[model samples]
Target: MTSEEPGDSSVVRRDRFSGGPARGFLSSLAADERIFEADLAVDRAHVVMLAERGIVDGETAGAILAALDDVEAAGHGALPDGEDVHEAVESAVIARVGPDGGRMHTARSRNDEVAACIRYRLREDALSVVEATLALREALAETAAAHVETTMPGYTHLQPAQPTTVAHHLLSYEAAVARDTARLLDAYGRINRSPLGAAAFAGTPFDVDRERTAELLGFEGVLGNSMDASSARDFLAETLSALATHAVTLSGLAEDLVVFSNRGYVDLSDDYSSTSSIMPQKKNPDTLELVRACAGDAVGDLAALLTTLKGLPRAYNRDLQRAHRHAFDAADVVGEATAVAAGAVRTATWNEGALAAAAGEGFSTATGVADLLAMAGVPFRTAHEIVAAAAPDVEDGDDPATVAAKLDAAAEGVLGENLRTHVNRDDLEAALDPARSAESRDSAGGPASPAVAAQLDAAADRIDADAEALTAGRDALAAAADRLETEVDRRV
Candidate 1:
């Protein structure tokens, strides 16, 4: 390889052009700065592995490792101009230790090195996302626990369908976010594998201990196939998919809160809400509206990533460099959105009287009455017809006695008997009461208070277990870094 003079361009361009406007078009330095620390760590691990495999002399490995330490101290911005951080770091290492520094690239190509660096940084990024999700879940669980018996209307097609508690509604979102956390943790399993020794699109000729480097980097294991290792980016797509799903869950929660605020069913904290510039009476859910928009952003990021990976052939491509920007953006947007949603839920106040007043509107307990008549041996369809016939008389302002008289007349017309023959007035009134209607649904996973209590307890347990898992992962990475640093010290 021909060496550029000291004052010449340090970039290793395959084309004839050394420096020009094209370099700016191809440069990834701005994005590459995100993974500079990971790049140095990969160098340290790779150098230690090389010396252990007898591929480089101890003195040369020590010199390269020490120079890498200097380059790290100088930071990514201090490096010479090049195509990317990998080239810039390599150029810095070579400048520090002369020709022997080139030995750092002996067993690995930029393809596998860049891949490893991405995985190294993304594992932590994914973990941070999971942590944010857990915080949101905890916030939701606490809010649900506080409102386990606060009766409200549950809707389908945005119309009242049944009576439910705020706890039941909030727990539903907690369930979805729990699944989102599981998807991310599952993706982490594959994302944490090492691709260090694949060397380019093929295995290196030198005998390299891929497992050793993987262990030193806290990866669960090495990616077995060299070509697949160099080309695979499915893990990134999988993570963004999980994030997009999570963002959708957040969007639903935000939409519901916005609707509740509109209906006077809930009041958001002033911190999360915004006032109109001219209309002094306006207090808008601007934070939630932005969170709802973030769902679209996450979905777009996932689409962009899948589209980028869709047509690329096996082995590394320049196109793969653009992939990280999508992953980083999706994770960041979703993470912040998750936190904002948690804050909104934690600080919002539910209007119990208003929610209860609306809960029984639209004859929301009609299903409960039908269920009660069916339990007394009336055919369900017959009972449904009897209630449907009397619904017009049971209007918004009618007294219970008048409503019952109308229902009795309807029942006699439908069944040729008074409605009291099979059920008493007390039973009928209990069935019609929205609070009793919600409380009557005591089956497992129902919107009843006891069911919601069980769900909230289960959510607490899941949050604790997931938090511990994240902590264990971080501890393992710290231990690996400690081991790597100790080994480097011995080699130096």
Candidate 2:
């Protein structure tokens, strides 16, 4: 071991080494700044656990804990020159309380300590993303409720295929967001597990209470296998996977709104849109465009994380330090995208009159007429043929009577009888109306008004349950922090 300076009180004993370009290249202080508080909490918890287990004397534990508090109060700028935040913090503590401060690292390695810090901070980050997902879900469901009767043309292959209400379309996205929220909560289960006692990838010889540290850190439980706990990054990969899928869902929704805005079916709120730099008449959906682009960014982050973790043979490697950066990028990007999408959905205005007018264009109600004919004793295939025959004669402004006359002529040639003989004009006219056509679809999970209302109610209940779950998780963490702090105060 070598000391860096002669007669320097703050010099830390370490193996002989040269510090130059390689030190700056390997330093993680920039990224580790995000988890500085988490590192301090882990130190306090570990020291308290050591004292309770008789692994360290009360006097040393108290001095170390007090020094940790001082180190934290000094802020990031006061951290010493080191390869990572863990070393910097430990160096600060030793500088403050002399050799007694070094006792704080008893029964733990930087491997387990850094892993615990990542998990502690990631739990809060995952919860925040879940909260944002819930907000978007609430916005979608409420918007659907308000538009239950707002009729519009539903598209397939970007062509008008049938009539559907705005509520039904909006509710589709709400259902997707509900599933996204569920996936994130499921991923949290793995993220909340603690890896505190897996010191240097093997069981510690010291009598350490892993569960005590886990409880103090608000973890659901300790990761059972020491080696796996020290090196496992699957939890981070799973979180990024969930976030990436959610970003895809948001991208699809953004694309739909962009298409709708382009087609004059809906108008976006000005705040979510932007004006082109050179074009005077352009109102671009720039926020949604960015949300759409976030899918690629999130996917890239997940891929990068997996690539970094792949082919690693062991319990702990320096490469693991690079993994958390990708996770942080994914979480931050998706969280912001989710918030912007919620705002866009909440403030958007639908052009109800324009939607109603366009709902019947391109022979969109032809399927309703065929179904009506099928219900009135006409063979479904024969009804299809009859409608196909009359489609050429149907004009944009043709009235129901004119359309009925064409259907009759086509039926006479196809079935040897007029369509009016089987179905009266009143029935044909009702089937030809797009609004009635949409209402006629009363099947379960259909786009009818009543069906959409039921869906909205169910989505609202799910949102409430998820919101409560998030609150409970957050409160549990807060209680654990309070308990840990209280224990620290009593010991020190």
Using TM-score as the measure, the top candidate is 1
TM-score of each candidate structure, all chains considered together? 0.96, 0.94
**Candidate 1 residue 359 C-alpha distance from true site, Å:** 0.9
Q: After superposition, how far is residue 246 of candidate 2 from its true place, in Å?
A: 0.6
Estimate every model's Cα lDDT from 0 to 1. 0.90, 0.89
Model 1 scores a TM of 0.96
Clashing pairs in 1: none
| lDDT of each residue in 75-128, candidate 2, tens digit only | 988787777788888877777777667788888888999999998998899999
Output the number of the lDDT-best candidate: 1
Quantify how close model 2 is to the true structure by its C-alpha RMSD in Å: 2.5
